[model samples]
Target: MSADPAAPRLSASGAHFSVWAPEASHVWLCLFDADDRETRMPMTRGEGGVWHSEATGVGAGARYGYRADGPYDPAAGLWFDPDKLLLDPYATAIDRAFIYDSALAAPRGEGGDTAPMIPKGVVEAPLAPLSGALPCFRPGGLIYELHVRGFTMLHPDVPEAQRGTIAALAHPAVIAHLQRLHVSAIELMPINAWIDERHLGPLGLTNYWGYNPVNWFALDPRLAPGGIAELRETVAALHAAGIGVMLDMVYNHDGESDAEGPTLSLRGLNARDYFRHAANGQLINDTGTGNAIACNQPMVRRLILDSLRYFVTQARVDGFRFDLAPALGRMADGFDRRSPLLEEMRADPILADRVMIAEPWDIGPGGYQLGHFGDNWLEWNDRYRDDMRRFWRGDSGMLGAMATRLAGSSDIFSGAMTRTVNFLAAHDGFTLADVTSYEQRHNHANGEENRDGHGENLSWNNGVEGPSDDPAVQAARRRDHIALLATLFCSRGTIMLTAGDEFGRTQQGNNNAYAQDNAIGWVDWAGRDTALEAEAFALAALRAGNADLRGAAILRDADVAWLDESGAPLSVAQWEDPQRRRFALHYRGSGLAICVNGDGEACKFLLEGQAVNVAARSVRVIPPAR
Candidate 1:
């Protein structure tokens, strides 16, 4: 390989390109100019199977792809086709939308020519560098998990073209709405370039949530108005509004699922090296999606780290919420607290100041390592969600667990590590509205019977199931929603609210609506119940006004005070009582008091060391103290 300055640099060149096709004898870099001109550039095969090429004139707005000439074999997991135009794994921008031609689908039968359906490589055109963006939010920051499309697809104010893309999110009206909601950061569901799972695409549904990642470095062209550049603009806009952008990254697995899955990018290039294989040479199925990424390997670790660095340094993202993060921490032995990947990320110069959050578990052996992550990392507290749900739904023997969760689950995260990402619901499960309206899962709309989502939702239907026109049931549901929000806001950790939860968004009881990219998943901005929206807005305001409540200190007197049902100090007996369902938590420093009644009937809660002047059903946050 020549060290020419004009040659493409994978990390630096504006029109640089690289591919991993060790088995290929030769690879060609093809560029299609704006005037429909074709330029064929040969790639130099470097050490470690990486092919590279660069050109001076090839830059932003250029359309290009790659072609590899290699031996063809299906059983061995090498399906190389020189005729197909592959996308670059590192391409920062996509010049065109992915056209779903039948020829592009995975080839069937005895593998006559099975490469067109696979991921294509390309030489990316570079745009302006992303710098000057600061990390505006931290671990204790409030995060609102939202779908870029879903948040504004039905928004009356958003333009038609911008409705479901990054452009919509950057709209001033959208920014103002989020600002009014009072969250510090927006944890967007995955926006990485992904292909709809073949089955979902066949069913006329798309991968709406964007969890299946194909190219870690490229933004999904479908989500961006002008491709990747639009994504950068959206991030910049969010940062300008004092809101941090945290991407939900799926590094645990690639879009390529299993043996039957399509050979998108990484798998076709080097399946054996990229994916974990059993001793018998079969693909490991730890991700529950057919294959697991080889995170323990040094080169694989470097790839993952390099991808993260690219996003941080180039994309200027504020933080990353790692999806199925336990897979990253898995080692040859088992889940390790000091995993090389985790340690490297913690110490990395570019990643050190960013917020590092983890889903904290996978489906593999010892996969449920929730509280086992390192100190600098914030974990999704599933235990908090479960316990809080049980308490609110009138379950017994949950008082202790609820109390522990309210105190930031100190048992899971001890000392200074008590900061958790607490939430009643996220994108994966039923929305807060659905949780209170459906006792049983109604995922038939997902076309997978009712067996697609989690069986144990820990939800209550409030005396009726599904949607109910009964005003009483509706009022109860609203109250339950308010209670859950209050609990989340007053809890001793960072809080995350689903996008539509604030305005009562329902998936119509479809908990796992990953494939429903249309109306099912999109937030109905026009159909919002104004009263409920106001309540949500008020809850956010209350949370913001009481800074001590969301502060990092576990023993801090500024935010929290324990009180009995009568608003007096909690007694030892009351703390130990399994039947107790009501407590008063007062943020003395912030001068806000919240009374919670988890019991079926209302309970009179007293303010500790203060006279009880006001009361409401289930839960209520008192105004700031005079």
Candidate 2:
């Protein structure tokens, strides 16, 4: 644990407890007995607003929480209530997962004795730091984003006991699947402890996606029953097989939500200092989840850095993909590329070598900072996704856009080394199969009446709204999937494939399946399209075998020759022709040619006197001459 030495540490007699609550009038370390009885021990106020306490009898495995006594002004963002037990921000292990209760949201004095409902931080001894080789993943590698539970819940080989847990990932069947995909890293989506939204309990639904995080350091008990050790062991197992792991972390907001939300860890401890607030003293809603963490604040930055270091030192994971990353760089004025938190992360020795990717947008003002994260970060490129879909959907005037996206999206990323993580589909939207099979979102199961997901998905139904018995429709969808995957694999920079997207996973057109913890969200391993899976494997192999395709360098005019179907250099008129859809990009140095035909008719392209035929709505990668 690279966290501050003041963090809870076990000694010969018992344990030393410490907390940072500068504004609180007093703080108490509450330890829970076997029967859930609480004993509050007074903590002595220390320098710099931190409180310290020595528990002579308490040792490892002791369930404990903190109670801070201070102001209780909601409007002024000073939420403090001794009734609401708070989890330690430095807690590495939690006794149980968080479940939403209406009482958790009740006002300070009204929500009496939340200890019964709240999860306690289990006192733990820090694991020895891992020392090994650098991360196995690198730029321009395939990143597979998957929810831990959804990915393995249906796996027949994974044990029933181990299913849907971090330990399950170490199973040989799972590692074999990853190896088949040639995955450089598997990005686990938000394994941190989280609470369900208050509305979900009433709707008979719960948060399936773990995006609503409550504690940054503690692993979700449901995901890792063995706690941090399970993660460390799983990571070691994956690394031994040449696969890296990346956590999709959420630092934008806690599950504590708004004033009406639950008084979890940060909100109950020091809401005024931990969360960003407006001039009117209202919590800032930059994250769309209610309150955004004050990343610019020194304590918040330290916490975030400490969390990152703890994961690295303990688990030895490859890297991280920050969810809604703009929140990390947002200051009082606006989002700054050189914000203290962002700069510190980039400069941190432990984190500098690790792969860092950014979601790159939020709902806040100036939140869509795509290419502004400077040189150290790779960003998820929405433009690539949109343009690729539009082009394959047969939208007019998308030839240039499609070519740009396939060429590493130079227009968006204006650097020598493109920082784009191009993908045809992601977890939050329609799957690749759904993109070709559904024109509208069907999310009534989510209780949102199909109005929750993105309205204009730039998708096509291919003569059917969803699944169809028509072989022609099925063939068309398969062709489109190949085209989409080929475009992504043939692109210049890093690529990401959401779990099951490689094998035609569909949410029945439910784009926003965040609340679907049932069969709708789990990857149907048995029902997956084997042919599509084979195509994905072949495409991955193709990308890996070709140096030109996997390189991160932005293509220049000298490096690539843009040609029309006739093999002649593309003219101004041809580039401007909206109706034209066939083109070939021949990499001059590698002698490789990528021929794309977005038209509904198969087209043949002449490359250096050799004719290469490409199917309609498909892309063909032609190898160089012998």
Candidate 3:
């Protein structure tokens, strides 16, 4: 291997390279220059299947991969083929796209089989000589959830090659759109190295949503134009725009499924230790996938912590949203409050400053622990989503629940836990457009006979299911969308808006389009009606501009005043009555009074003391009369 003299070695400056390769009898370091020529070097095997090489010349900007010699036993999850060229789990950069070749799948040393199936590794590229330092945006920031590919895939202004890559997102036009949206941060869906599910491949579909993570350190080559350097440039561009990037990480499980699944990377190396198993050695299914990561174990926790540190310090990632976060806390009895993984993450100086949002549930028993997370961690408020949906859909006995959600759900997030990441919709569920367009999930296109995805959508089709040409139905859907947006913005917590939700993007009722890479899942930027889209965009901008709406406070001066129908402070009867759905919430912050009319028909309700700006068939925020 050819090593760059200027590149920093893993052992230099307290850095260490590690890979789990239990089956490998011997492994070699193979470095390459920009010309793709090999620079061969030997690596020493350490305890517990770790291989290390110390050299001063090998630093960032060096191109390298690994070669292993091990048994190829697919049945036992050992797919080790050193001749196929494997990637380093600690690799910071990838050189090229993974060109699928059937020949690579064949058995080694055959007439047609060139080599064994080996994972490719990439070396870090040299830093730009004139690249300026980028600022790291901190936590307590508003994160705009978006798909890198979907965000600009259909935008009229974006170039074709740059459509789904980081370069496209950093394009001036795309950045302008984000700047106009006024989001403080962007929480990107899983961008780590991933593989399309086997089922998706069989159906000619792709895992466009990228939730299946294969390598925690390497960025997915599909999302980068010129490999790792390109990603760095993209991060630099986003940082220059003052927008931080938070990755939605899937650490609770690996891309490898259960015992029947393919032997990809980690599982193939060490399944018995990496994966959580029952006493009988059966894989745990807490992640709803085939297996759950053993986070309670020391080595597994170390791997997770190492991955996080690499992203934050090396990749310059600002924060992370842990997928199936409760899995990270599971132990022998159940979910442990004092899990060492959680403690280390909280106490770590590098991670402590970053935003740690959790999808605080798994598929395991007693997994839906929404508000039970410890201090300094924010949770995805599923309760808020359900309550908000019910109240807007005109469900009975929902008014009280709505109040608690609107005020940041003090009942759930009691004590030191304060912040809640509230959202009406996310990537896994129906889009805002689908919410009002379909009562039943239409996932038949997913090639799973419409049985996939959640059945309990809590959606209302507004008198007719699916798409309708009726202007009245369309108008009502629009009104409901606006109402939900208003409620989301007015609620007392950090709000997260799925990209394109502001413009009413739809997935044709496919709530779980994780496998669909077509136009159905891609954001239809060109189809947006400028007039309507502009109005919605303005509403989002307005929400972001209003400082009082960003997060919760102590309500120092009783900023919120609840009023009954007759212009009086809410009485005991009015507050207790389950039938009462219409009420006014006057907010003193920013000198605004928001009147919510939840009833089906518009009622002429009196204002408490002052004349307020009221609009028919709408949730109106009346600013103080100046």
Candidate 4:
């Protein structure tokens, strides 16, 4: 579906590269030797804004880069300094570790050659067609999101050498954990090659969240010790185990921060055309990052589609979750659900059946298109997150909103056509444990003076802040933890749980642990709660075995009944009661009644002829006639 693709096409004799750089009068394909010696060969220019070249004896594992000589004007957004060894936009593998160097920061002046300072792309062979069929990780299935590094960094069962690597995620222990939760897919946080923000090194922090992407196709060396092969192997293992792999992609923008950021890939080649700049040539900031990509451009769109197809055909990933996804739907006038990019992806034969999840918002004007995505695209439901948090926190008049959320958030995602990926916490926010342990975000460790993360987290401390030693506070937090997980599993539509949240994991109340790549961010397997783990398994089993809960259609009046403490359907007066934190939802024919009592004291609910007592701040899933 791409206009021009397969940039580096491998041939029988050698590898051929076709780059799009119309403005450049000349472009050099630079290859490096084992001693890091450079070999420069000029590429011939052709019509349609393409540059082509082929080199013999250069197939797989060959290190290469490109230098385009055109114009250099920051104000005009030219950014064409040939001194920088720009990474190939279509690079599939990269060599060496990425250390944040100040020299790589801004184009302050015509910087010297950066070949010795930065990593270069590796020439890799094309992937063969998979022997088996793709995994059927349907859109509405339960998804477990996790970070490769954080999930395995502190996992004692994984070998030390494989820890934090793509290979580590395939360990038997990790597989068992996902199986226990009955997760259909694992939406891995961005494992693509990324850069640590220039401000992090000076602040003694690291870019642990992986949002600041540098190379679109290559895997980050730190996270992929064995590169693309390891990723493919890991995904195959997951597929064999009946679990799907979904990648969190960041195509909305690049790591080239601002005019003052790194000249890594797109920025160095042709900033004026590759990036969206104002009339005065100022970079657009739609992504909240320094520069928003001009994806409407044919070449940029080609790059995105090519990278996507590569992963599907090569790595065998089941799907993708686009971060800050609104940027993908932006046209000249505004965001369009039928934008060329969105239409192209949907029409593509390879991507149509695969799962596509959109974050569905950006920092640009008219950007929050929550429920505005086209058909077949599932979206992250922030409304569900807020309502669930508020209701469980004992907020007044939250019962009505909670009812809507419980029914797959039909108020927003009305279509039984597309499902919602409902989650209480993700990588960018407080972990489930932190949600009940801290009222406010404690991100002082992020070097931003506790001012980095979301201010209004809708979280409660139970009775004390941070870690609690008091038995009462500890007991209450543990109960609320189970209650939140229960609500997620019981809610209609697909649910997502962050890794390590099953047995209680905390980031010390730091909602924005994007820069805290230490023990605070890693999962502590040694300290997991065994009892809570069993409870999580039971909850998963409950959701999996219920046909009504996993139905493909939106539930309406006859399908659901909102009952009061008397076991009868609630009246208008009772629905409006300020103290109606206690309620029950009897899913028709599911034979399960999910009762919640958010009060500070125990409450009794009439279940059929018997009055069953449920403890306060707890959620109980009862079977009919039990």
Task: List the candidates' TM-scores in order.
Answer: 0.91, 0.98, 0.87, 0.97
Candidate whose lDDT is highest: 2
Candidate closer to the true structure by TM-score (higher is better), 1 or 4: 4
Ranking by lDDT: 2, 4, 1, 3
Q: What is the C-alpha RMSD of each candidate to the true structure, in Å?
A: 3.3, 1.5, 4.4, 1.9
- Candidate 4 residue lDDT tens string, 1-626: 12243456777898887677778778899999999999999988876667788888787888999988888778888877777788888888899756677677546454577888879888887677553465558655789999999999988889998999889989999898888888899999999999888889999888998999988889999999788889999998888789999999998888888877888878877788788888877998998779998877877887888788878888888899999998898887889888888898999987777889999889987799998886788889888899899998889999888887877777787655437878999998999989989999988998888888799999999879999789998888889999999888887777888998889998999999999889989988899877788888999988888766655466687877888888999999988887788888887775578888888789888877678788888888887554
Q: All models: lDDT?
A: 0.75, 0.91, 0.72, 0.84
Instruction: Choose 3 or 4, whichever is better by lDDT.
Output: 4
As a TM-score, model 2 comes out at 0.98
**Which 10 successive residues of model 4 have the least lDDT summed?**
1-10
The backbone clash count of each candidate, in order, is: 14, 0, 15, 0
* Candidate 1: C-alpha lDDT: 0.75
Which lDDT tens digits does candidate 3 get at residues 365-451? 779888777777788998999899988887877777887777677777775325788899999999987898899999988999999
Off by over 4 Å in 4: 1-7, 106-109, 131-134, 624-626
* Model 2: colliding residue pairs: none
